[model samples]
Target chain A: MNDTNYTPSVAYLGPEASFTHIAAAELFGHKGLTPRPTIPDCIEAVTEGHVAYAVVPLENALEGSVPLTIDYLFHGGELFITAEISTPIGQHLMVNKAQKDFTDQLESIQSHPHALAQCHKFLQYRYRKIPLIQTTSTAAAAKYISEQPALHIAAIGNQLAAETYGLHIVEENIHDFHFNHTRFVVLSLRKEILDHKNHAASKKTTLMVKLPEDDKAGMLHQILSVFSWRRLNLSKIESRPLKTGLGHYFFIIDVNESEDHPMMKGAMEELAALGCTARSFGSYYVYETDPSSE
Target chain B: MNDTNYTPSVAYLGPEASFTHIAAAELFGHKGLTPRPTIPDCIEAVTEGHVAYAVVPLENALEGSVPLTIDYLFHGGELFITAEISTPIGQHLMVNKAQKDFTDQLESIQSHPHALAQCHKFLQYRYRKIPLIQTTSTAAAAKYISEQPALHIAAIGNQLAAETYGLHIVEENIHDFHFNHTRFVVLSLRKEILDHKNHAASKKTTLMVKLPEDDKAGMLHQILSVFSWRRLNLSKIESRPLKTGLGHYFFIIDVNESEDHPMMKGAMEELAALGCTARSFGSYYVYETDPSSE
Candidate 1:
């Protein structure tokens, strides 16, 4: 019954160069891998058992939550976060070195929509309207642009993407915000590890719960009451609408203890009785602050 | 010497059919009006005095925050939420009536990238690879597909958009979430408003605050502590990167009171003294909960 007996394939949103894909690979760290083509495909793969695990992005500091990820979590079936990973955004102005006039010589700025968005001011100052087109992924934009002309077009992307497409970074760390970090969640057919060497890491469990139909008043208070009564330290609680029904919603809470912890187990039992769907996504101490090289 | 002596023209983020445009019309209902191309242009109009006010979408109930809107508030000169309005998601599957079996014979889905994302599952179940494409606006998509000979392509848009584009509503209320609401804030050339009527109709005051450079934990707790001290009810608090230097962040707080309300004004004064950037938008209370009728 141990994980050592399992060799389940892992699926993630990818083109082999997506930030999500990169985060997934890093989260898995050389485990069984099967990169899927789209976010939904990865969700479907995990739901169908085509793969034992899947990885997707939840939110970035710049952009709050990945609406799709929230939708996937709310819409029922597919997956749950087995573990969470925080990825840093150290984007740069990537371009093919063949073109000159690097400083203020941008005709068009290109990258994944999200990247283009995160560096909103830089583009506003430099190339507001030369046509900020889209690519399938940041890597795709860099690869496609580097192949032909990098004259006036520059792609703002991460260093990994710049390296993958063999492009030079014209300018480094162009993100308007230096504290940018994206929280990515790992989902698998199996459960994540909770026991850790450190005491601080011992009491952490992630859960997603669906609120009852109708009644929006005192929403958070009602959800918190369950945790407070159980003496569970409800460290974080966020709400995402249940994508299907009206007035129904999903509440994700980060508790300060393992499910195996005696008191926390009692809270989970009461929470389960509330008709709330809860999942244990490993218990480990997460970096309390955004870590950046800047 | 008074706002009563001057009535300012405002440009919003859309045409007649866009939600921002509708919000502009609603906020500036009888106020002076000017139309603009993009959100930034509207902000520019306000900043440069081309218009007196510019309305921008700050956040959604389902999606945490509009990243571009937040970024604009961070970079654009001297702007803050002058007023707030909440509009429910009026989602519809709009199609050219020429297409007879629209659902059974559908080939593609078109809408703004966000709208497309919001209705991801409905399309996934109904039409898997039916080529979900993005447009500048949902109205733009509706307009674009109106002239196309391909009868199978349809757009998911708002009711006003469908009516304006002369498209038929093949399906009503198609958004994945039921309680979908987008909250917009009006930005102005100047900080203060003209009259008490504006304040009387206002039920919320939205403010932007930057965490002081001090590295004390619970800076947010400190910010909220002020409101708690005054027994002020907070509607929501969205945390976003400050878009300035490293490790710095900004918080957008929506409080349940008009700007003129003593509780809110006192809190604003305290917040400013704590190195907060506060701007009070004119107050109007319009809480439309019905997603379809809106």
Candidate 2:
């Protein structure tokens, strides 16, 4: 499986035609792709040596971070992020081909909770009386709608789902905000991928830091002071529970520099001196989806 | 509707027996409690004057922040946090009474995604081949299992759900971790509740701040410096996208001081001087659920 002649297999969170699937396609092209039912399954596939790589959503511009992905990476196991991909999210109203007048025949809409929330204004204004059913994923909802023979049912999902499930797009771009985007990370058990020259050229490092048990006044500020004094730019900062009890959290920071950078190294050493444990996941380049390719 | 003789109505996110319902009951004690079908619906019920107060989950001990609640509070409307409640979460595996041997007869387990994830270890070890179905809520799953006459179906939910739906608890405490808890906030449009003596003595304030259009290095550090210099303790800090674009975000900080405190007032003024806009939600005491009362 480690031979260069072997076809590399990639896993993603999917029921097919999911946003994660689109991100995986953007990164791997038409190579061997496997769709896993959940985030954990996708990562497990990589850890268990069934796949060479796994792609999972890290955060969304509109909805914030994906909790499952972050929690698993922080506490569940040790998997390094090899690369990053950012894709623009476009949600559409999909229905069976027999449904012509959606407004008149639309009895209920089915979709993932996030998709329904993203199209809040459109749903409230048009189908105020109808109910909204929750599904595991937008792609799952599209598959369900395609399998049904009802005219009053529809789903809110991406264009890829409509195409894959043989549904017709009744309306396009129904999301409340036009600038929705999701960031996905490529995870792999192989350390060689992180040491690749192409990945090293991109100066971005993500670190997970856990502060001292005694959280005194100005403790967080002290940790931030290390990076502030060095003038290292931080692109994002998020906190997740340690799961020990209430009020216990660990911080994840994305810095605009590589792990080997002198400033980042100094900051990490200073943080360790201040009773903080910091671990660098990896340094990787982010690839933006090209509109022309889509 | 605002008369003294009127019995105020309260709303919670529910199809009944939800965690939000339990929080609402602990606060209102069965006084005019109404169950809203969704988080947005519960908030809208209060905003439209249909209900006097709404109870919604803010964060979980294991799952971190509830993105829907945070996003709605940040961008949806003008509701303010009047009070806070913390409830212990206890999950149970429930089955219909007719099913005596669930280990052999169980074909599917239905639950909300969070509930399913929390009970991952139990499900995987005991019934590896059973299909897990996703529902809108844990309470909804319990209701569905109760209504069906099939012995092959089961649900993972709270004890209240088991009792409410007349199901038998096959196993208790099925969650992966023991210390599971969720923080709920009481939202209201009325200002008189915040002026009460009990709420004024809590001395905890939550502030939402939006940085200037140009995000520069060390800007967040400067904002934290205002509180650090005064020796004010900070409980939590979270960032959410401003919906403007991919790189823009606004910060939400929880300070261990009242909004009217001189130190907090000075911090807000200094933050404003540094090109940031801050709004105080409120100061209130947190009530922990009493096991004996339940």
Identify the candidate with maximal lDDT. Answer: 2
lDDT tens digits, residue span B123-226, model 2: 87898899998776788899998888666899998877888999988888887765556778889987434332222245577889898988698888888898
Computed on C-alphas against the true complex, the DockQ of each candidate is: 0.18, 0.47
TM-score of chain B of each: 0.81, 0.89
lDDT tens digits by residue: candidate 2, A144-212: 888886558999998789989888888888877666667898998864343322222455888898989
Interface RMSD of each: 6.0, 3.3
Predicted structure 1, TM vs. truth: 0.74
Model 1 agreement with the true structure over A1-294: per-residue lDDT tens digits: 125666557786665666665565554544677766545667778887888777776765322236566666545544555566667777788778776456366677676555665666677786666677655456767887788663667887777677777887888887666556676676765566522122234446777776555434444444566666566665454555454633445666677677788877776677677666666555654432223322
TM-score of each: 0.74, 0.91
Best by TM-score: 2
